[model samples]
Target: MFIGVGVTIAAFYYYNNPVEGESCHIQKENNVAAFVMYGSYFYLFLQFFLARYFKVRVNADSDKKKKVA
Candidate 1:
């Protein structure tokens, strides 16, 4: 789904901004889109990291309690 959206957006960008002669650079908005996309991916990674961190902490506490008992 994400791949489709990315490809569709890229197609529209290239269609609107075709290379003429010398300049072949993407528009400023296109660069911003790239950053936004990466930001979303980073957010997902952060969520995964936090979930794992808490899970490990909970397991360690449980193990310590069992050993004390």
Candidate 2:
């Protein structure tokens, strides 16, 4: 998650800084690109965490049920 966030931020910073653009010119003016990139990364991380958490919970529950039986 941290790595994803770091990479996304770094990419955004690089995109925001254009080497040859004029001071008043804007390259990525919509800002949707950054939002989409960051959002996708965040969503992927969240899904991963949730899947792992649910898997652990399910295993623990099954173990408890077997012990009780």
Best-matching candidate per lDDT: 1
In model 2, the clashing pairs are none
TM-scores for candidates 1 onward, in order: 0.42, 0.39
Candidate 2: regions farther than 4 A off: 1-30, 56-69
Q: Write the per-residue lDDT of candidate 1 for residues 1-69, one digit (tens) a residue.
A: 367457646755775677676554556676567657766886898899899775645457779999999
Top-TM-score structure, candidate number: 1
Q: Which tens-of-lDDT digit does each residue in 10-62 have in candidate 2?
A: 65576677467644243464345656776888899889989987664545777
Please report the TM-score between candidate 1 and the true structure.
0.42
